[model samples]
Target: MAESANPIPRKAAPVRTKIDHLRLDVVGPVATLTLNRPERHNALSLDMYHQIPEMLSRLEIDRTVSSLVIRGCGLRAFSAGADITEFTTVRAGAEGARLYNLAVAEAERAISNFHAPTIAMVHGFCIGGGCGLALSCDLRLADTAAAFGITPARLGFAYSLESTKRLMDLAGPAEASYLLFSGRRVSAERALWNGLVNEVHPPEELEKVTYELAVEISKRAPMSLRATKEIIGLVRAGQVRDDDYTTALRNDLFESSDYIEGVEAFLGKRPPHFSGC
Candidate 1:
């Protein structure tokens, strides 16, 4: 009777290897991205450059994701800049430079216009293209160990006008010019003083503090945050001359669910639990 039937062996579950250069993880309403090429100090390869736009697109459409946090893996650096190896080939001539510049422009636009609030949780080196990524974020929280520079001058390359303007917006004309001219790394304190970063935390506390700040931001009204970001963009572009959309957004917020919850919670002496509706 025991030999009458044979049991079938079960197949093993698949094991997932970490992506070699980029890591994406979700915690509650926050999506965290890590540059994973630690052996090369997280140098930005062409593949890494392309993967960023796709990742940002994914995060943008995920309604559950209210905010994002970006940092480097292994704590050595956020990104040491573009992979110089690839640059040798990609920057070889005018045609090559044109294609490479187009790719960079697409990446920059994707990061800057992503729907959710984004935070750059920077540590160690954030230079060149890395600074471009960090500047695209709505907020930047750097560790005391962090350093920043835009090194196109040293490389005999001219930065895109949009990238230069973004840096100027964060650091002002004088500091932006100094860094661009010298190609010198600025200290975290200097970056903070120049408004390049929203806050500077100790190295050990950077991850924890950045996560806390992301959660705080995620708990706010989504519509208000999105509208504010859009309005800021219009203002920056010199396109916000008494627009009806901007006025409507301001009026609509008064009647939002978040506003109702906010008032009730205040009266009850409790924290508002916004659903982001």
Candidate 2:
């Protein structure tokens, strides 16, 4: 049999687009969202905060995406936290602070509810609002050079119930209290020990290692992964009984295509190729 040769030409690469304080790049099934204000230690400005929810919405609906990585543009910071300079003018009084806090609450909600699994690759200063952002993600990976802190105490601002609870879920009540009350920077090793970070790598290996983790996650079944995330959120919110959902999901996984592939590959002594079905 002779193979037919076609003359259809390949299309040009899509134009790479970038927003003012954020950059989205997709390679294969993994998407990386970078906070782009490196000159300011990637501080979360009002504009950047507003842009996040919108960007996350787009990623959630994009079928091509299988995993997400949130990171800072430079090694100096994942974020230095909310831009305090803007707070001076934007949060001038009690009423203004109330409104600002409400907006922040909405942004945090969006991150916490993102459809796919998310990883925060933290380095340098991840403080105040940055900590809230990282804690919202499904997993957090920090570099050896990273520092973690929640600075509500230092700024004389009260932390929201949701943000406080998220931190407590990661580090337990006692550790969360220490960080929130003192506003002290903790080393990456301490953050890991306290359960704030799932993994810590050398500074030079951070980005590469983060991408590899994302790739591994992308190989899992999409439905099962998303269901697991949803169940975790339900448990965290105290809206559901853990045993009920846990057992149902475990049974559901047995019928999944990825699970079949995983088992077969194990028996066959080969690597499994999962389509995330």
Model 2 shows how many backbone clashes? 0
Where model 1 places Cα greater than 4 Å from the true spot, the runs are: 1-20, 239-241
Write candidate 2's Cα lDDT for 20-109 as tens digits: 988876666777778889889988877777778887788777766678888887778999999899888887799878877877787788
Error of 2 at 22 (Å): 0.8
Q: How high is each candidate's TM-score?
A: 0.89, 0.87
- The weakest ten consecutive residues by lDDT in model 2 span 1-10
Which parts of model 2 have CA positions greater than 4 angstroms off?
A: 1-16, 239-256
Q: lDDT of model 2 at residue 190?
A: 100
**Clashing residue pairs found in predicted model 1:** none
The lDDT of model 2 is 0.82
- lDDT by residue for model 1 (93-178), tens: 89988887777788778878878888998889999988888898889999898999899999999889999888888889998999
Clashing pairs in 2: none
